[model samples]
Target: MGDGLPDLPPLFGPVFALREGGDALARAVALAPEHGAGCFVWVRAYARVEAAVVLEPEQPLAAARPALLAAAAAMADALAALGPPQAEIALRWPATLVVNRGVVGAARLAAPPGAAETAVPAWLAVGVEVRRALPPGVEPGTDPGRTALEEEGFDEADTAELTAAWARHLMTGLNEWQERGFARLAGRYLGWLERDPAQAGAARRGLDSATGDLVLQRPDGALTRRSLRAAVAEGVA
Candidate 1:
């Protein structure tokens, strides 16, 4: 705890700090059923913000999947505040964070074993990590298509503050989801979502309300759906 990850806001407590090698997602999943909600896991690291939080959803796992979208959008909100003005923060589909068009990091989700799509999950955990800098030998811009906060003019970015902000924003987003509906959260998420590189602007994409799938609407109005469920099965990251 010496590295100074700020204390998370109220409601996120029973904080569990782990070693640099800890997997926030895995640890949170292990703790979820016993801890219930508001359990937090912060993976200690200097070059990255690695953390996860647990949420107990009232809805079924399938319908609750957009919680990942909400988490991603919350991250977008958190990064927007930490980055320099004019820095573009966006999401690539479900939960990948993009800053100034570089792949910074991503959010991933997990549920208890045997949690069915139709049955309410015992608990859901959303984990996120964003790079603060490149590894030792890699020079900036020497590596294309990826970036970290330091290289992107995030001079004021602090992993501690970023972690705090992400949690608070996530709280706010989940609150909005409870007050309004998935549409509200989905719209906010999709607003910052960028088109897939392979099909940029070739179609308009939106989140499926019932299931959090990525729906692409072609100019001709034909629709193609990318299953979020399948994506999660493959890997949410």
Candidate 2:
């Protein structure tokens, strides 16, 4: 590889470059237990960006959901920084990232399977993938629901720069969560969620303070909740 990803914070450990077609998330997961924490793995795919980082946390697995989500936010922020002005970046609940209302990519989290909610996982991996360019023969606007960075005027953005930016932003996010609180991280994430004014009043949505679950209030005062942890776990599988 040797694209020379930019220098990251000291706490981010070392970068492991994977050849094209390599799975960054799987590599990070396999190396995490041995590397302990802070190791990052990335692959510069032909038309996409993929990367994952290992994390070792003192808190229980349940409480760590916010940290994983923060990583996703960091990735989104990094892309936004490099993307064209008014790119209209937004995040779907839990992990998906959209630009200009088109699905560009998503983030995912993985931990020791069947680990108890209150137990500290041996390791946690946060993975991110973004579409860098449309595949050959694919035309823009062919699928209004899907898009790539190139199609969105992000010609200046590249996988290596995005990888470096993500690391820095993730470090900042983790520090914010530790020093300030999850509320601070949560506010940023909530603000980026795609919202519709038409849904206001008739029903409302918010995040649960403790578990990071999506809480929806119905018109009849009934409440429904969806766990972000469960969402991440499912995505990992």
Candidate 3:
């Protein structure tokens, strides 16, 4: 772990910084069962980054989806705070984060393999990674659909600062979820979802608080649901 990490809130035990090429999510997941919750790990790989926090929930694993979503929303809020006023930060369904309409980062959730949905796992991990700087020899316009923080005018926001901000914001988000209920967190997350203007009138989409599923409703009264848990299990975005 690296030094000089900002003071974290009470819920987060310590900030463990992984060396170059280290996988934060993998380390956190491996240690979670033993260390339990409040263990946060992060890695600052050149232009890429990785982070994960361990969580221990009293509720069953199936009911823990809200916690994961709240963590992702907190991360989004952290990025939004560091970004310029006009910069657009949004979530792409379950995991990806879009900035200025371009892909910049993503979040992931993990638990023990084959852990029963109805049983609380020994531990859970929520990991996130964002591109801090452009890759070498990569021009701004080379990949218009993708972007890095520096390329998007966030030159002052480095990986360390963002990681610290994420910890603080995540603490706030979890507290709000506990006090105000999941609806409040869900509403904030929904606001950050990107939507196409042309399809705005075609259907309405929302997140199911209970199961963390994407619910879509059409004008014809047809409803479709996509499960976040299933996506996590299948390792799909």
Candidate 4:
């Protein structure tokens, strides 16, 4: 692992720039106990950028959902720096980044296997992967489900610059969460979600602080509590 990356904001944690052979998640998690929170593991892969950040396990993985959302918002800020056209970039719940209405990449998260509530946690890690280049013969909209920066007309950008920008934005957003709490992060993320007309009947309610669930009250006097845990486990909003 390499270190000493300047320009990455301090809250991103310690920087561990990894060679191609390293495992991104494992590398970040390994540093948690010693490096403390915000330790970052950035794995440089050809044509793709991947990274992971350490999350201390004071609560179950589910309880960290808000921070997870904050991470995604930070990535959006990074992508915006690439000069994506206005309104061209958006994030799909629970963690997919979309460009021009096509999926460009997604975020993946991992915590200690079988982590339990009240367990101070080994650490949680959130990984991000963005495709920079496309393989030959794979045309945009070929999948109608995926895309890349190059395909999106972001050829002027490169992985190094992009990764550095992401580290900064992510750290800044994390700090905001640390200072002000998850409500701020939730507001930003909730703004990105596409409202479902079908769910119009489900009165949009706020998250339950006690259980960390989103409670939707229906117009018909019915109430539904959706577990933030289950939503995050699937990793989609």
Q: List the residue pairs that clash in candidate 1.
A: none
Each model's lDDT comes to 0.85, 0.82, 0.79, 0.69
Candidate 4 lDDT by residue in tens digits, 134-212:
7678876778778888878886667767777777777776667667876766666666654445347775655554334
- Ranking the candidates on lDDT from highest down gives 1, 2, 3, 4
Candidate 2, residue 6: the lDDT equals: 77
Where is model 3 more than 4 Å wrong at Cα? Answer: 196-203
* lDDT string, candidate 1, 210-235, tens digits: 89998888888888788889878888
Name the lDDT of candidate 3. 0.79
Candidate 1's displacement at residue 176, Å, is 0.4
lDDT of 2 by residue, 1-237 (tens): 336777888877667899888999899999887887889899966688888889987788888767667877898889888888889998887788899999999887888778788888888898888888888999899999999988888888678888888888888888888889878888777777776453456376777756778777889998877788777767731
Shift in Å, residue 102, candidate 4:
0.8
What does candidate 2 score on TM? 0.91
Clashing pairs in 4: 13-38, 57-120, 93-237, 94-236, 94-237
Superposition error at 186 for model 4 (Å): 0.8
lDDT, residue 13, candidate 4: 60
User: After aligning candidate 1 to the native by TM-score, how far in Å is the CA of 179 from where it should be?
Assistant: 0.7
Worst 10 residues of 1 by lDDT: 1-10
